[model samples]
Target: MSNGDGSAVRSYHDRTKHSPASVRASRHALDWANQPLAFKIYETLEPIALPRELPPIDVPALEAIARIESSTANECVPDLPTLTQLLYYSAGITRRITHPGGEIYYRAAACTGALYHIDLYLVCGDLPALAAGVYHFGPQDRALRRLRPGDHRRTLIEATGDEAATAAAPVILVCASTYWRNAWKYQARAYRHCFWDAGTLLANLLAVAAARTVPARVVAGFVDRAVERLLDLDPGREAAIALVPLGHTRDRPGPAPDAPPLGLRTVPLSAHEVDYPAICAAHLASSLETPEQVRAWHGQTPRPVAPAPTGPLTPLTPLLGATAPRDAIDRVILRRGSTREFGRVPIGLAAFATTLERATRGVPADFLDPPGASLNDLYLIVNAVDGLRAGAYVFHRERAALELLQEGDFRRDAGYLGLGQDIPADASADVFLLADLAPVLARYGDRGYRAAALEAGIIGGKLYLAAYAHRLGASGLTFFDDDVTSFFSPHAREKSVLFLVALGMSARRAQVVPSA
Candidate 1:
């Protein structure tokens, strides 16, 4: 596959697909001794202490997740405290667990294997109690370490071809990923996790921004080299995945001063690291080289509308007029964790419908045209839901209904599709997010894969929050890609599974100490 061509991403996806035979044939084993550290540490930089005692936004979790658009008013700039709260609720370390091995720092968002490979950086103009500069978010210490001084939002604006959101934004959050941190466990597939993890983080960011009335939008179209250079990131190791413009401003900053090389030091991830060339190749293949290319990639091609449902379509009972969950976004995120075991108890149909309705409302992203359009379709295997029959169904986001695909218990089938995990088999519902890759790849080239997977991850993240807000449990799981498509064939014959999230009642309470 040619570099910068969409082929590289397509090749990687086809190569990394999970199958029953592939799983059985593989002899991969975890190397506990060589496990990478969950947090990225910068050695020389002094931490810029952020406010730990943040006042929580009062927006209900359900209402927050359902917000589709960001505030457009220019006066809605986020001050230091608001920015601090946004970062904390989005990617900050929320819980600490002590074990014989030592401490495990779990973050605000759900990550694959709890391996927090994704890192956050801040670029902004001066704000109340904060200076204009480039800074890295150290979730371990809950502080920001300045990497460079002076405003640098213009660099991002240029990289994004003067994207409207980035141009008017007072602060921009850059999401990057360190390959080896997650690759230690997932290997080449860790490439996909880069966007998946970022998507999950953005899920929190967008929701929190909405709750706080801060303008925010995910910017995926940007010159790859430009962003990496601005962040001083090694493209081969840590690369920028997405840029999110936070808050709003009528004034645009002047041209950025030349960004010189900064040879900053970072603590080693582990005693040793493994390199996966496939991951790097896939990234390079989908990367946009020029600002013009970035501009062209801004909008997504319109998806073909689905035909009317011929089967029995059950209208969704969304919690629109019903009272929303009282738990605020921060409290919900602090309590959220991947369910280790499901109770197999049936969740009320209203709760299930609320989760689906709220999560799929849509995301404000660059790849999605018209802002709120989604790139993936949602399919579900209903194991147990009060008032819902045990069967398979595809969600109609537009119509707000479920089109019955098959009527039968798919407990075993769900388990098999989820790489033989009991989580899906035992959960109340397993949402399989699938996309037709052909059109996606054709439209955005190889990068569309990232957009599709990222969209699924964002929605999956929302599902996690919605489930937890209602005092239920939710976990994101991997699946046998082809099998998932096969299980939902006819309706999803051409689509490929991008992400899976299982939701249900928890079997036991998780033990986690709140972060100080």
Candidate 2:
């Protein structure tokens, strides 16, 4: 709830942590009849239907994004077709499956509940093939609906205190979460989901932008009220979470139009939605009130180190080189979907090794441990990895091999750890990321929550990329907090699980191909 006001909030370590009984106790057994939806619909503005025609892009362009090769902001500008391709590949529904229950649609990224709540809004200057305007990306239809017809990039620049990326971007992408979409299943935890879910989606968006040779950067600090008004969203329900400045333009943007409120209407997503108090409370706490406040939160000093590695250190040896003849990130994304059914089989140790090597090769971020260091530790329950013994092990970044802690099949344990999800139990291995949080919270305060979640997502995103590269399957998973810490305890005693990813062979091929 604390958006980022330098509040000395207690980390998850300091909380009067919930016991199994306490977790259930804190869980408000919602009365289904009384469930309240999360989005606050304004009865005025008409629903603007999006365009249905989205052209296809080449795989090489997509690969450029995943590899961050498209990050150079020079003279390149995104045309209308490129914009459409980015949005469609980032969050559009790629596959629809008919089940006994009904039809279930899968999106571009793997979200916790598959509760697609995050929305994309575009602000830009006039460009070739498209008029200059503020627009909303409709994932369902793979199109853009014009909201305000003019350049509004200057408003964002002012909101971000003229952050270099925001100031120079030709078009900016805004991500907002409608609380109810996820809260329907997760309730209060939806607040955390807002970032986690959004982060995963951004992972795809960022990579896609890179593929298009469009330079983009994530901006988390901005004047909250100013952005909320510019998009005319109800901060209580649908609030902006992050921004991405897409491509570059030589011409400086002029002043933004006075953001007069336009109350928009939309169809209800579900029958009902339940509100979570803790989530909303946490969101409010971190919100920035002014541009000055946002400016103050921009930079962070490098973390001080204590000691060097003492454990067996092994450097990663990925199967494919950075320039391997792999499918482009765009092609991989169009084909990616979370594995709902994993086959119980031993994944080649080399395959597992390659994934770790490629995914952990550091992401571009200012808040990381250092240039090559990461804040979290990768621990695993090796249910099955060919040529590797079944065991509990810690991945030493310096040493690419598993430092075995204990050996045995913990398939059932893995199932329980994943909050009873069958995916982890059946997967060859489940990679659990744990971090020492005392220093993290002390350094960044409540904002550390954002860092931990974001870092986990970037790596998880890389895992998705790496797994696909290896002809394997992977899915981001959720778990019982304490149970996970306890599973990797003694060694992981002081550490906490930040994120989980299950990797193995999938039982069925459900990859989607976007309509041309």
Candidate 3:
């Protein structure tokens, strides 16, 4: 891959893409004997146990999924219990399936292939029940292991260009990805999955924070090396992807002490690791090097091109209060799972409309200026729905309507675009998020690639919750990137594929969280 240029970014994207010929010609098989460890375990640290007695979030799942920011007016800081809830629901283990070989631990969010590659770390000042420190959240035991023992938020404040949220935040959450853990299955494309999996987890994180009335905002722009250094991460194996500043504070941290290396030890993920140079090169190309560069990188959100309605337009009628489901956020997340096999059943148009409406409302991130602006446009292949025609369509977010792009059944094409996956063909509807990367890369630079994929995953995560609320099923699927754009073109000629999500009825019921 080329170095330090936009073409290098495109090189990684194009090389990792799935196509008909590439899928058939490749001989990449799973190495079951050397599968990576599920958890990133520290061998020499003591675990500070978190509270097992958790509080219930009573906010309705639908209500919280649509909300972008907290409604609280006065300043509030999360206590030990509130902090516990945030970590537990977002990534903590909620259920275990006992197999003959051993057990499979399922987390709060659905990850690609159940690998659980994403990890969360908390950096905060002195709180009511906790001391100032940098800590790693261990889901295996529902406890935190301190990595450094002093206030390090000042370092983060500077890393994020002293952004308003990070400066005022009392607690911040940093999400990072260990390449080998996910790359064991995905190989080079694991770089993309890094943001996709984190986006899904952020969905859970943001929703739980909102239900608890804690102000949480996602910061994607930062001095990458600065954050990696604060978290004591090795750029080779693990690197920071996103940050969430939780709660507001008038108080600010003074200068942080010099971070001498802790040199902590951890269990090995596998006996041998395969190095993918493209992943590192792509990350380096996108990474911001200094505060000055970080400040200049962000600007106005890219406006999408919404052509005039070329066909029939059906305005979305999402269910409102008193008519929508009242299930709490906890219940929805606990029941959520990636649908293994989608049944060819027709769901109500209202249910489909509601999911799209709530999930695309907005993402609370720095890249999306003015709150509700989005980088991607939604194009869909509707196969089964009660009130809507079975055809190709594009969703107009501002107008809240689905404009028919073409009137026909494309079940075969749906499966093809999804890389010959049955889930897309058999599902009620398939949504492909396409982005005009020229503007995204031009505006946000190579890092914009990360932002576009991240935003798609966040919205994709919300779609998961929204679908579950209506008793429907949802799954994130891989695609043949160029093929998708071609299928949705003339209109999408300049656009590129970012993500795909399928929604339908489930073939079998998903496992639920066992009661205590």
Candidate 4:
């Protein structure tokens, strides 16, 4: 198998070395205005109206992926209420705040600059209330707009090279991101935001599924053109990032009839658009044109092997205990948001350990650190954890213990690493995910770039769930790429920081009680 050493990957890797080019000269600024819309709308197809009144079933809060207790692939056939709940929890509006400009709505997950680029689409066979068709999830209205009417999972089956789970699934969810939405703020790096935002959202969706007993698996490998065409998307502006096959069904996929080209229009998100050439270039470079390419892309490789312990493995006996009583996702999400302000309080070391252990048990994925291992490393700045000295530590998953690296009051340093954010200094601990990119990129190519970010974001998402389950607070943050690894020194020299999450007790408690 050829490594993702293609010119596309090489160009991307080279671009990373060069200093930031002038924004004036960047194609992202000029070319974006003329680029085609991300999705191809079908004017002929009527919109499939989704259920407004969603299910009232309260979903249990799942703290850890390993602690997920469902084995059955059977789902509840998602009535209007269940579907509404899924949509709301997955990408629905949780909060709206008024500002000088106007009002800004925040979703269930954290996004870069709050510039939401990721969009959700649902394709399913005829179910109890809904029909067999492809529909677009509109978080704006909390409804689904029908794109095409029929069982469209077959296109996914073909795109995924007939992956068994996708082929047998009842409903498949597709996640796509429009570049300009996030690129306006992040510039070329909007490409990275695509996966990061998607992973954070998927974290919610997956947890919701676990709570609802829906078996879902994320499929990153697929024929790019097929999916792009099925969604009527222009390859240059937007593309499919990931696919989730929801609910196991013995019923096989029906034959995929030809989907004709669609030319529909959508309201422009913003007046002016900015294009990132490097993002477009890298995306095109890593794109798989044929199903054969997708098949050959995933060559069998030996899973990662953990090295023998070099020193004493700290046993985390105090952390293990029964998880919090199942809290509903609706309540958790309503209470969830990025912590802009944090109060310096000492959280119990047991609570910290439990949160880490529960969150990192393992995310169900084909490309993972190992069967039970993860792709990213968890490093933390212990500002204040009861019974644990304030310092920097590396979480040893195998031993379920945090190995002390440097012991000191590094609140100031923690803030600096988190791009000089106040929350890091105020929080009890800052969790950073570090990874050896060379191996991951080698095994999975440029696509591995997506995997690493997604894995970190998913874990970060779980961290949010874990914190909220214990009535704590958490927030996703960004950091200086090289500085994070530098702060952790010799131990994390080769590793690069993928994502950051700050966890602790909230400074202010909400007075209003959540509805039952």
Candidate 5:
């Protein structure tokens, strides 16, 4: 039951690694008839419709993705319309394609298998055109369904162990994932997708918030059970993943109302539910049980052991501050989609370098001490990037350069490492985030697993936006975890692979807007 026991998380990660023999030996199949519902339906709760006509966030997408911290220092309480805009661009349905079987609803962010398992909820004090309450965002209807009535920000403040942003903010957005919705395709591994999918969505959220100059901070360390009780989430199915407090405020919350169960009924996700004990067990293994634990867990960023590179180095030319592409963030997010097939073409070294530099700048999270530290290291498989040799390399984030690990055509190796997928082979580059979890788990315990995975997801999400900012394409892919570490060995020795992203020109542009 101790969250500090990291072996539980390690065991789960080892069991889920996909190998050539393991993939071929698998017997998993999708059940189209029993597919889980995309939206969490509360049939009894009346929908409070959000504004339809939302304003465009005109900040250039590149600039927005480059900066993780909100620009504003002054107190800024967002109006209802601002909230609507935030929600729309973050998780709203952007477009849909009608098919003979059904319509495929495309969202603002990319998700593995297009499962749309991640959900958003808002907890706020009374604001213009909105009442004080806890509300679940129903993306299907573009509405908020009230779950608790009254100011509940104090509950989150306590849940986060009095995180500075949570204590000062007037509103908090809770990100949660319903396992079966994604588990239907990924099975037990869907637990990892919980953070991966949510991280992509958060990239959009943080960008939109920055575009509007709203103060926001990502609080990942929290008393898990308290927040679950406050939100009334079913421990077996849906669980809160991260908390983002938006728009600073001077006034403190007086107190919180009781969070007794309302026993609200929800429409079943599918015709039948199959339990995945591994998912629940892994979650429980890393969960924080008390505010004291959460308090002790925050602000302890581990210094991952990495020696100075012995290989050749290539300095990155990232577009410095204020000189970036002007594609509006809202537009970029709307146009974003997971590129399926790479064009097998070369992209500018600058474009690829910008993604690495900007995405790894730093994330504004409670788990990151001094605000700029990170738990993951960036390793790359370069296949077709212009002005960069075709080879494998490791990113020297501090020096803003790449250290060549090996020089050769790695397309064949990339394909094999990415679970034998063609995307990584054809893409201009593939980024694999590796973390030495011995130090991470030692510093933060099993909860360090959550920190590492969440940070990987957030950076992968940023990489997605950074690629799209330059009109390139990007997609997150699963990899042979141990193989990835082996490929970047010596430097990446003893490190665990947290996430992988493929970047390049799409073979053909994905349909951002469906044709009539």
Candidate 6:
């Protein structure tokens, strides 16, 4: 497998899959004393404090999540206060938990192992309060530290091949991941976590942008080396994953000034870090090198047309009228947390249907073809839901219905598929996101893996918000990859599992600690 071929990604996927037998055969143990720090710190740079005093948006969570386009005109630009609120609610540290050894700072979105590996950066022209520059977001201090002293939005525009969204945007945010931060726990599979964690953050960002009626779009196609150079990142250690254009403006940026080397100082993540060659190889194989390749990658691919519904289909009954929850976007995010324990309580059918319908409507992304078509299929193991049968079902987004596949109680099977976890067994339903990787890789090359995982994470994030808004609980869980596919065999025999989310009522409420 080489950098130019898609076979590398397929080989990497096959090599990293987890199974019951494989788990016992491998002897990997946690290095507790050598754990890497979760946050990146710039030792020499002075932090320009961001305004902590901010007001919450009044848009309802459901209304915000359901919005695919902004109602306000695209000429509106986001001011400093609005930007502050967006960054705070998207990735800021919202809660802290104390234990005997130390304290843990939980962030706005859920991450695998709570290892906050993803970092956000801002690139913008002169705004109301902020100067024209490139800056890194320091969630640790709730501040922004300037990395470059002038407008660099044109650099991103050129790298993205003058993408429509980038051409007309006033502000753009770059999301990157530090491999060692998450690899310390997840090992080689940390590559997948890069997109998952970033997608969760984007989920929050898109919803908030819509609530404020700001135009935004997620750009996944870009020249990898150009972005790394602009961010001053070591491609091997830290790599850019996605670019998001914030608010739209009619004014286009001029040619960017020369980007020179700035050897800045930063605190190390740990005393020593371990390297995973497989992770690096996979990333390299999927990287796009030229503007032409980026443009070609953006071309739409024909998705397999869905066959007419022949199986028994149950139309979804989403709560749309007066019964929908009116919680604000900020309040929903602050209250969002992974459910540690799910009580065996059946949720209302309308609530369940609404969550599924609203979350899968579509994501404003570059990789998805025809704008609204999804790369992954939704599969469910229904344990409890009012007016729904206890069995397995596959969601047909085109028809907005669930096609019954198997009819029987499989709570124990669900638990086993989720790596022997009790959450899936006790939850009302376990939503499994699976994708047919063959066509995806064939169309977009190895980068499709990132797109598939990211789509899952975004939808999973929306599910978390939906559950919380409706007064339910949801948690993103890991599962045995092959087992998940096998459990939904025949219907999903050729597909691969991308992500899982368990939804139900929480047995105990989580405590929220104020930020320090």
| lDDT scores of the candidates, listed in order | 0.88, 0.71, 0.88, 0.73, 0.88, 0.87
Residue-level lDDT tens digits of model 2 in 1-516: 345433433332234233466566775665555444322343443445444565544554224433543545367788877877778777788888999976777788878767678888999888877678888876655556777878888888998878877787888999888887777766655766777777777777777776666877777777777888888887777778888888877778877777788766666655655565555556666666767766766666334353354444334455554544367676687677787788777777666777787667665443553445566778998887777778787887766656777778899999988878799999889999887766676655566666666667767877776677666789888788888888886778866677899998887532232111
Q: Tell me how candidate 2 scores on lDDT.
A: 0.71
Q: Give the alpha carbon lDDT tens digit for every residue of 301-405 in model 1.
A: 558788789778889887764565678888999999999898767888888999999999889888888756888999999998888889999999999899899
Candidate 3 wrongly placed segments (more than 4 Å)? 1-5, 509-516
Clashing pairs in 1: none
- Badly placed stretches (over 4 Å) of model 6 are 1-5, 509-516
What are the clashing pairs of model 4? 28-275, 40-232, 41-264, 48-146, 54-81, 55-81, 55-82
Alpha carbon lDDT at 13, candidate 6: 83
The C-alpha RMSD of each candidate to the native structure, in angstroms, is 3.3, 4.6, 3.2, 4.5, 2.9, 3.4
The clash count of every prediction, one per candidate, is: 0, 22, 0, 7, 0, 0
Per-residue lDDT for 32 in model 5? 89
lDDT of the structure predicted as candidate 6: 0.87
Q: Write the per-residue lDDT of candidate 6 for residues 1-516, one digit (tens) a residue.
A: 322546888888888888899888878888998899888888888888989888868888988887776643638778988898888888899988899988989799888999999999999999999999999999989999998988899999988888888888899999999999999988898888888888888889889999998887888889888999998988889889999998888898888978897878788888899999998899889888888888888868547675565667889978885678889999999989999898777777888999998888888888876768788899999998888899999999888899988989999999999989999999989999998988888888888887888888898888888888987899998889999999898888888998899998887632232111
Residue 430 deviation, candidate 5, in Å? Answer: 0.6
Candidate 3 displacement at residue 171 in angstroms: 0.3
Residue 291 of model 3: what lDDT?
78
List residue ranges in candidate 4 displaced over 4 A: 1-3, 6-49, 56-59, 63-69, 72-77, 97-101, 299-314, 317-325, 369-371, 509-516
TM-score, every prediction: 0.97, 0.86, 0.97, 0.88, 0.97, 0.96
